[model samples]
Target: MIAGRMALGILVALEVAAGCRRGPAPAEPVKVIVTKNGWEPWKIPARKGEKLVLLVTRTTDETCATELVIPEAGVNVPLPLGKEVRIELTPERTGPLRFSCAMKMFQGVIEVR
Candidate 1:
């Protein structure tokens, strides 16, 4: 009975410590501008398992990057010219997540660590 009580006490302590611990802080919103050159800041950085928010705005109609596609994340969305689009995703693993246009012509990389 004494051993059982000690185990229970340890479990309670661990639970309390876990409850007091904090997760990674919420990331700041990243703004990506789509010009004729394609997605600006083509290389993005992210942390695995952390929520990432992107504020994407397209400023040109001449580019073929009329849409954003992230195949691995199952994301496909249109980017209307001169409008801001919010994209939220969490990197499940550490690697390069590729985002490209509908035609796969223009591309960008999200480096997750």
Candidate 2:
């Protein structure tokens, strides 16, 4: 009976060990709201060399804010009206990367520290 209990305990421990996460944990995507004022939570914080996923949702059809531009990262994405778009990036360095509208009238930043 003692040997069986020991084996059961070892199995449970093995299962627990297997469930533990290894290496870099997957980062949850950040949600950004786009309105007439541009991106909400514009200043995004991220770790260096970490992959970031920005999910942008446009809540208003005001102006020409249908498109997004991240000049430094060379990302120019068109955001559909009242729809969501995803932007994935891995920041290699630490600094502020700007994201703006096509007309550059509205802007925001991704702060990597």
Candidate 3:
């Protein structure tokens, strides 16, 4: 009985150790709202070398921010009215990256550290 209990304990310990070796957890996507003024929470915080996902949703039609343009990242996507657009990017450097409307009328920044 003692030998059997020792084997079971060793097996349980190994299982627990394997379970702790998981990879990095996925980063939570940031929800951005487009209003008449511009992107809500215009200042987004991001970590360097990590995947950044942006769930962009346009809630108003009064603004010229019908598209998102990230010149540095070479991302230009049209924003459909009342729909969510997913934009994923991995920031390689630490700094402020600008995103704006097609006409450059509205702008926001992603602050990476």
Candidate 4:
């Protein structure tokens, strides 16, 4: 029973840490994991006009999310398989900015505050 309690505590701690991975919490640059399954943490948080460093890593070759597009910023960057694509942008206004693949099949959003 004691061992189980210890394990539960550890699991809870880990879960809390994972929950805070993004959302203006960490000092590190924002990162998104791209895979055949789709974008992990699809919603990104940012403040308008504040520079954001976005690091996107494509972990699979079969995924159709091969490109990242931000129409307002005039960005259409490609993500090569097994590579990380770094993008920098400053949200010009408060609203949802959509980013998706070239095919428009997979999509995500940046919530500018």
TM-score against truth, every candidate? 0.78, 0.76, 0.78, 0.73
Q: Give the poorly placed runs of model 1, Cα more than 4 Å off.
A: 1-24
Can you give the lDDT of residue 109 in candidate 1? 94
Better of 2 and 4 by TM-score: 2
lDDT of 2 by residue, 1-113 (tens): 45643432211111122236466874898999988777888789876777677788999987777887876665778889878887777676677777889988888888878
Per-residue C-alpha lDDT of model 4 across residues 1-113, encoded as one tens digit per residue:
45643432211111122353445443356889987778887899987756667889989878788888765565678888878777876666688878888877888898989
Q: What is the lDDT of candidate 4?
A: 0.71
Model 1 C-alpha lDDT per residue in residues 1-113, reported as the tens digit of each score: 45643432211111122234377765897899999999898999998878777789999999799888876776678899999988877777788889999999999999989
What candidate 3 gets wrong by more than 4 Å, as runs, is 1-23
2 against 3, candidate with superior lDDT = 3
C-alpha root-mean-square deviation, each candidate: 13.3, 16.2, 16.6, 16.4
What overall lDDT, based on C-alpha atoms, would model 2 receive against the true structure?
0.73
lDDT by residue (tens digit), candidate 3, 10-74: 11111122235446764898999999879998999988767677889999999899998876776
Q: What's the lDDT for all of these models?
A: 0.78, 0.73, 0.78, 0.71
From the highest lDDT down, the ranking of the candidates is: 1, 3, 2, 4
Residue 31 lDDT in candidate 2:
96
TM-score of 2: 0.76
